[model samples]
Target: MKCPLCGCEKAHKHGKTSKGGQRYLCPHCKKTFTDTFDTIYYRRHLNTDEVHSILQSHTEGSSLRGISRITQRAYGTVVSLVRAASQKAQIVHNAKVQKIKTKEVIGNEMWSFVEKNKKPVSQKN
Candidate 1:
């Protein structure tokens, strides 16, 4: 395995995580990291299918509490998952939208001025 911290290919098995994923140790960087390090799923207990279900339910107009009840997850977990997903989507949107080129823009404007006095200025004076 390769060491993620130092980009070294001399990594050895250090231990196993609580979830049974193998942990690697890098001699060069003297650091221990797992295969999931730095990933969105890192440290997350929920599996992919569960998270997908939660997001799908949320997009289908399910409330956080309702999602929690439906998915059998805690309400706080549902809220946090939704918030994290929203943040990720916003970031992706900003990145992709920046690359789009605007071909054309159609617009119009009108300008007008109104006077309180209806009489001609010369006649009023």
Candidate 2:
């Protein structure tokens, strides 16, 4: 694996993270990083399935509080995950939408006009 810090190709197996993920050490920069480095799952305590479940529930119209309650996670954790997911989605959307080519577009607009008839009634004295 390439070193994330110095972009060096000489990286060795440093150790394993607490979660059993492989860790690498870059001899060029003397930096140690895990396999999850620079990834969405980096430094996250929750496992992959839990993170997926949280994101899925958020997309499925579940509120943060609701997801927290259902997942038994802290409210702060749910909020943080939701924010991170939103940012990542925005990044992906920007990247993918920039490559789109548009030709012709069809659209419709509706206009309504309301008129009230005004008639003066003769008053009986």
**Candidate 2 lDDT, 1-125, residue by residue in tens:** 89988999999998888778899999999999998786667888889999999888877778777889999999878877777766676688788867557798675432211134479898999
Q: How many residue pairs clash in each candidate?
A: 0, 0
Name the weakest run of 10 consecutive residues (lDDT summed) in model 1. 108-117
Please give the lDDT score for candidate 2.
0.80
- How much lDDT does each candidate structure score? 0.77, 0.80
For 1-125, candidate 1 gives per-residue lDDT tens digits of: 88877899999999898889999999999999998775556678799899889888887777777888988899778777777777676688788867656888664432211123376557544
Model 2 TM-score, 2 decimals: 0.73
Q: Which pairs of residues collide in candidate 2?
A: none
lDDT minimum window of 10 residues, candidate 2? 108-117
> In lDDT terms, which candidate is top?
2
At residue 26, candidate 2 shows an lDDT of 98
Which residue runs does candidate 2 get wrong by more than 4 Å? Answer: 104-125
For model 2, give the RMSD to the true fold: 13.0
